[model samples]
Target chain A: MSESVNQQPVPLHEHGQRRPMKKRLWWIAISPSVWAIHFLACYITAAVWCEKIGEGNLRPLQISVGIYTAIALPVIIWVGYSSYRNFRRGDPPVPYDFDDPTDRTHFFGFTAFLLSSLSVVATLFTVLVFVLVGSCD
Target chain B: MNFVPSQSALDHAGVGAESIAGLFWVMLIGGCLIWLIVVGLAVYAIVVPGQHDQKRTRMLVIGGGAVFPTIVLTALLTYGLAMLPDLQRPAPEGSQVIEVAGVRWWWRIHYRMPDGNRVETANEIHLPVNEPVEFKLKSEDVIHAFWVPSLGGKVDMMPGRENRLKLHPTRVGVYRGVCAEYCGEAHTQMAFDVIVESREDYDEWLRQQASLAVAISDEAEAGRKIFAGSGCGACHSIRGTSADGVVGPDLTHFGSRRSIGASVLPNNADNLTRWIAETHRVKSGVEMPAFETLAEDELRALVRYLGELK
Candidate 1:
């Protein structure tokens, strides 16, 4: 069993054509980065609207945060789907327990998929606030 | 443990407080249920004699850790956020409006009467049960929060901006209110009594508060003379008297209050004397000066006079 696991081919990335470590890490981090940007945009929009426009109208805030959620969710879902595909690439899918190059790539894919899933939920939760709170008060 | 219950948010007496307490119970019970399931799974995995496959283990971890928490937390968020609109809804037109200014270490309350006149009171608040009252909260100096935990949620009293809170007391009982936000050295001492009474009783109390302070006895009459002679009128106001100062609490109905010195002491002759003679010792950093220079007889007379203002 150990010999067969060691003999598995590196199917995703070719030997010399592999991407740099930094670029690969960026792919892992992009999901949470999108979440962070969405979070800040929602907060700044609410703060400015409350401070400058005063209370009684939440239409603008709801529309702006809705737009941000729409933009963030699709990107996160795509990233998560791609990561899931990468994570399941091996002949005997997941538990990615081996110490080979292919297994390491699979582990990274698993981590990115988990992060993307979390970001999608978090972005939804942020949008939930705008929907529930009707005014600055 | 002491038998008497301390101040708690769960001791809900009003509509808003009831909703808050409900949310707290739901969250607490939901969290405990989730904790039990997660811990039960871990205990079973550790103690059970079985060879669990990686696929089953992965499913257990993902289902227990991520999916469960996300669903539970999102449900809780939705339930909690749904309460905000009703809690923040403004009182209807022609509601009884009370303007409460958070002064240094005290509360300055003004009731807008039906005929457009304002009646001023301090340290204590009275409300009619089952009637929604609009409180226009403000701060004279630093930031303060008006929190009657049993009545409603706390709202910050900013210096320039006015924040509003609506409270409809369901029970007729005395509840304690405190400055939830720390402001100064005597922050902890800033407390007041919230008396929820019948509509007729509330109206009667407000009527008495709007009236003038009359000196009924010779001792009270003599004490009034001393209060005027000693310049106590500079920062204090006793309506229908020469003391028209707006710098301190109105003393027109001081004797009728539940507690003296912002609920620091029980309203009585001895506590009033101590508070008047050694104001700083009773509550440090208070803006009121201690009347240490007054003679013993004069102080007694002054206490007599203030005690009779009811």
Candidate 2:
């Protein structure tokens, strides 16, 4: 079995870059990352505040959520706007051609834009949660 | 006669448990709808005969994948958040408070009387129906969790700090409670029974728990002598008698309880006999050693004595 496997020609896909280098793809991740960090900060703040100040007091948890929302919303909005601008700049001459540089770039930008939009909506939903829920039991 | 215990989240006997049940149904229905739609769309895309248009495909992906989940999740999140305060509502003005400390394999229970005296018991807790009862939980050893599936959710018992859970029983019945966290040996055998009764009945039971044991038979007296002579008093206690060991469960009213051996077995003659002879077979990690060296009649006498203390 080992001899036969070695003799077989390696698949062409194994020879080159598995995934293309697209630095701008990181843009799509910004909104979701903001949402995650904000969630962690909010949760830790609630737990520690409750432990220190007592579960009866809700002011600390409420204030922490307020601050988390205020800081997270603007950053996610900026990332979403940037992705939208890149997506709208132009379209490839012949769309859906991965071998063509311009087409690949266009595809990456559009995907980033789409993901950013979804993430922004998710971030907003999370902010609403922080605002609406106000207890630590 | 052994079967898996039914632990369903929908069976709510307390207000905390009721709110949890309501949340569960909402999530269940919503999740099923989402599952069906996603699967249906995928199936339709594969089976339907139609021209594939890029614009239509993009629109479908954006609408179904992004918009639908966002709307549904946002609504669920808001609803869940709105119920938080209700779930943690403060206990009623005169709610009774009880403290339960988790040990290696049992629960040390304490009821705070109005006269500032705390009545201590073990393994079993009795609560009055329709009354809010607050449980102040702690741990004497490693981390353990207190869970009565039919009554409410589980709460962790941390070693150094205190946590509180409030339960208001809506029904009169016996609920099985078990240690949800794995502390050490015999964790699976660390079970307790919560008896919910009417206020009058619960008060009478409480009064009985505060009193000493009553011995009325020669067999019991003979067994008591054996228990004292055999050094059982070093780790066991029968309040109102000479045996006052604090290392194990209090057996002052053990016979009257619904179950014995920390809910591992029903409190009956045969099971009690087997427990004294072969305790390891019944619960492997239990700290008690077998009394197989004792003669058959002596063991029977001891079992009868322990069985009739209630």
Candidate 2 error regions (>4 Å): A1-29, A54-57, A93-122, A125-129, B1-7
List model 1 lDDT by residue over A1-137, tens digit each. 37765456665555434341212656889899999999999999899988888567788789889898889999999989887776666554557766676766677778899999989988988888888877786
TM-score to native of every candidate shown: 0.88, 0.86
Give the CAPRI rating of model 1: medium
Model 2 chain B lDDT-worst window of ten: B1-10
TM-score of predicted structure 1: 0.88
The residue pairs in collision within model 2 are none
Instruction: Please give the DockQ score of every candidate, comma-separated.
Output: 0.65, 0.50
DockQ of candidate 2, scored on C-alphas against the true complex (2 decimals): 0.50
B182-261 per-residue lDDT for model 2 (tens digits): 98879988889888889999999999887788764888778888888888888888888888897777788777876767
lDDT of 1 at A133: 74
Estimate, for each residue in B131-154, the C-alpha lDDT of model 1 and write its tens digit.
999999999999999999989999
List lDDT for all candidates, in order: 0.86, 0.77
